[model samples]
Target: MDQPIWLTFIVAFILMNVLLVGMAYMTLFERKVLAAMQDRVGPNRSGRFGLLQPLADAVKLLGKEDLIPKHADKIIFYFAPLVIFVTAIVRVAVIPFGNQIEIGGQPVALFAADLNVGALFLLAFGSLGVYGIILGAYASANRYSLLGGLRAAAQVVSYEIILGLSLVGVFLLSGSLSVRQIMLQQSAELQVGPLTMPNWFILSQPLAFVLFMIAAVAETNRAPFDMPEAESELISGFHTEYSGFRFSFYFLGEYINMIIVSLFAATLFLGGVDGPGADRYWGLGVLWLVLKVTVFLFFYIWLRGTLPRFRYDQLMGIAWKVLLPLVLLNIIVTAFIRLIGNGQIF
Candidate 1:
């Protein structure tokens, strides 16, 4: 059953704020982590342990002068950043955070909309984000910005195919595209000398997990595959002409996209909200989801600190020649395993 309209609105409003706050802190987390890796002190001036750095950054961005290219398309320039920011925030609606919790003796699901085709919706929305990138670049009236936008579009188009195929193995194993049902299917417990653990897809489809991670990083335009805004090649890439809150919008969108994919990885492969004690306390499930997403987010930061960006040709090669065939094979092999397990094939 669908949630009450009022309740849905309340949940969405709360979740949206949570996402925005999380994105803010993600920057702080990345900076501190990178600083540690490089043997230096990070943002410690704003608040205790630099907890207030994000807020400070937000204030600074807001107070900075908003600039536009003299020859820019005013309407597209104004709306492009908003498009990216809104689309990035909206994809969280279909992700199931936890099973259910009670409030005032009434049971409430932990997600906003439990779409039947949640996976497809994610793909569609993710693809649409490219439009914002392209539009922003074109409206900037800058050659470098256009080149960055083209690279981004090409990278997204290539990686998206592998991203979808990688998840086909999970969908095949779970027999559903709904994120909630997939998590439910993974809820079955395993026993080993009285120790119980959830049966996550990561163990069964390790290859898929690896492929998905790579494709997701590329899709989000992160390091090692962040050819779009590569500082060496294109000065800040597609949003080069944007400043102040306009630039901040694109910045927030990127981090939010990172969070979204991290959540997807957790929910799909790591048995989201399925940690020990989750069954006993619904609130723990939410904590588990958060913990899992945090791990992936940290992993993302770690990669940025550790790995060098890939060359433009190498980026395309990895998507087409490496991840593509591997994911296709994984899907085919998963299907055959399912058929044989069901006694439908020898």
Candidate 2:
């Protein structure tokens, strides 16, 4: 029908496909990096440098037997993976990858939706991720699965508060809840003595950046915080009973969530798509966004390679005792500074 609506649909479709393919390759990339770290050559058989490994794994998974425990709850078990996968995908809708691009003489944003409340929407969907884990564990009718699911729920709950609070500094500085608006605030060039640089929120709010990343890593249940699915003890955790495509759904969900977190962090703290030439060329904006996201993704894999998993008690303690207070202090300090700068306080 209209140009903007049609363009939005097209971009949304393209972005979704790109994210799915990216998530697939991320697994390959992680394996290669991890192997290199551990002094192994990693996958080199399926395709050149194992480029087609993810595809081969997908095909193999598709052909495997789909099994459900005899005593499992049929409905919840059937839908758990789908729930997780869909929720993970939904979180990306509001993420702005690039600025408006000219196509067919009209400008269109490189995002599915541009809601003013994008930040709140991202956090809300993120919180729902644990539901799928809980359902999967309960529906499987397994004790270990249930334990893993409960752990995941608690872990998510603990860190989610810290995650939300950690971003308060960004929201205060940007004065908007929209992710794109937040990036816009950081797109300005700042001058220091004779040097000029992008005024990314990361430079001003280093504390928030660190807190956000720590909580984000915990939120995604990545290494060190991966007690829920600690294979050494939980035997694959909540998805233990899942097999074939069902298991792949959970795997896909995790990688997609990881990508979303990195992208959001890039947008909030690293100035999504903001860099030299980004203002002149929309394509460069996309490139900058991708580069920033790539760095964050590599950081995730690096942490997994080097860090040992945290103990259950230590994990909860870090969230409640350490991150929680730091985030709260960050918020208070940020608010006070903003007030003083605004001449509202002496």
Candidate 3:
């Protein structure tokens, strides 16, 4: 049965809302995680264990005054963050969350949309984010915003080359571009204490995984790679002129973008939501999926806590000189492995 269509949309909407909410709290989680790493106490007053901090923060942002600079381009100014936010969430449609679920006697895939070119689609959507910061800064007409936007565009464009190249190895190994197909291949790879282990691509392609992680962290404009939004120097960077929800939207886009990148990392290298006999056991599948994504989230915070910010020249050099070459080599080596196995050449 094709499902009632309405049910499908409703499920998707609810899932997206949950993801959005979760992304908000992920900020709190990052802070808590960072605090623990640094031997300090994190937020504890907002709620039990500070569980309600994100909500409190959201309320605070909503209550703040909205500001629009008098000299800004009012139209694109308003549209920039929206474009970025929408693109971030919209890309989620193509990624499988926990396989499929039987709801009311119908098996519904847990993704928003399954694209033939799902992985490529995700990459393309990621590229769209560069425009958000670029346009936001450009329209703001502030020197800081404009400079931040330029930095973002350059960073994203440069790092994206490495990002795409890193994935080519996975696509070659799986012989498919669909995210679903890639997950199926990953699921076939492990043996874990009587239970077949989830064959995470991370193990098979360790080099590519490392390269991908570096590129992805850069792509998200995060710490160490956050040259665009350099705080002390640029004064909040691109969103310097933004306030209240307007500022919040940029951040909202950021955390949500983090989720997307983490999930993509999970999907491509972490075997997504697959575990031992997950197809046969409904709950286990969800567990594996969450576990995989959580590992990614943990790594994100760990990097934040452990690594200092990279200088602009150093960042670009790593992206172009180190990462790009490594990615290309991974591709060449993977292609050679495939060819020899197929007896295409010696």
Candidate 4:
């Protein structure tokens, strides 16, 4: 059944606002996690454990002067951050938060959109974010910014291959590119001798899971793989010339991208909204999804706190020489196993 147009709009509006708020808090979350790991207090003075820190930061950024370098391309510099922010927001439309639930006598899907090619939709928008980084860097007209953009371009391109290939095994196993369907496929229970558990793709595709997580970290430009904005080297990378709210745009976009990736990984491998009682209670499914995404977010923070930045050559080498081949091998092995299970191979 088709959803009412107004309903879709309402859902989109709500989800977008939630994402914005979530993006703000994600900074606090990361800071707190990192602080705890480093034996320090983080943002506690703002609002009882720094609950108001994001707001304070937003207010400060808004009040600061928005600076543009003298040599910057005014037009592209103005447009680039929006490209990153908008693309990050757009990717959230396809992530399924939970199963459908009744609302005013009608069943409403817990997601914004349910396209058949939702996974590809996500990937396409994700890839477009690079344009923002590259354009922002070039528009800055600063040597450091330009170098950062160059590194971003190469890193994203290399890791994107591994990221995409890592998911091919999951796609093959579930026989669908729609994330919703893949989550549903994983909802079934699997029996392993005396144990029974949700048939999450991670169990069967452990290699893909590892590869996906690694590529995800790179794809989001998180630490260790955050070569683009290496402060020690590029002095803040692509957004080096941006200040005030303009810089905030890039910051918001990065956190939002992190959230989206965490959600995507959760859905793809952790059975998404799948957990005990999730089928019977949509709220439980939503909770499960949130919990899973939180774990991934913590993992992201953990890596940032623990791992040192990778050298430029090492970053590129790992993506091209290490992750790429492993993902390809995983795809081949998955395909073979699938064929055998389907009685198409001995």
The TM-score leader among the candidates is: 4
Candidate-wise lDDT, in order: 0.92, 0.92, 0.86, 0.92
lDDT of 4 at 32: 93
Across residues 1-346, which tens digit of lDDT does each residue of candidate 1 receive? 5456788888888899999999999999999999999999999999899999999999999999999999999999999999889889999998887877778877778889889999888888998998889999999999999999999999999999999999999998898999999988888976767877668999889999999999999999999899999998899899899999999999999999999999989999999888889888988888999999999999999999999999999999988998898999999999999999999989
Write the residue-wise lDDT of candidate 4 on 1-346 in tens digits.
4678788788889899999998999999999999999999888999888999999999999999999999999999999999999999999999998867888888787788889999999999999999999999999999999999999999998988888899999999999999899999999999999999889999999999999999989988999899999999899999889999999999989999999999999999999999989989888988999999899999999999999999999888888888888999999999999999999988
Give the Cα error of residue 21 in candidate 3, in Å: 1.4
Report, for all candidates in order, the number of backbone clashes.
Answer: 0, 0, 1, 0
Tens-place lDDT per residue, model 3, 1-346, is: 3667887797689778978988988999998999999999999998899999999999999999988999999999998988788888888887787666887788877777778899999999999977889999999999999989989988999999999999999998889999988987887757766876557788778999999888888988888788889997899789998898888888988888888888888888988877777878767876787777788888888988888889888998888888888899999999999999899997
Candidates 1 and 3 compared: the better one by lDDT is 1
lDDT string, candidate 2, 1-346, tens digits: 1355877888889998999999999999999999999999999999899999999999999999999999999999999998889889998899998767767778777788878999999999999988889999999999999999999999999999999999999999889999988988889988988988789999989999999999999998899799779999999899999999999999999999999999999999999989889988988888999999999999999999999999999999989999899999999999999999999999
Worst 10 residues of 2 by lDDT: 1-10
Score every model by TM-score. Answer: 0.97, 0.98, 0.95, 0.99
- Supply candidate 2's per-residue lDDT for 132: 84
- CA lDDT of 105 in candidate 1? 75
Stretches > 4 Å off in candidate 4: none
Ranked by TM-score, the better of candidates 2 and 4 is 4
For residue 265, give model 1's deviation from the true position in Å: 0.4
Regions of model 3 farther than 4 Å from truth: 190-198
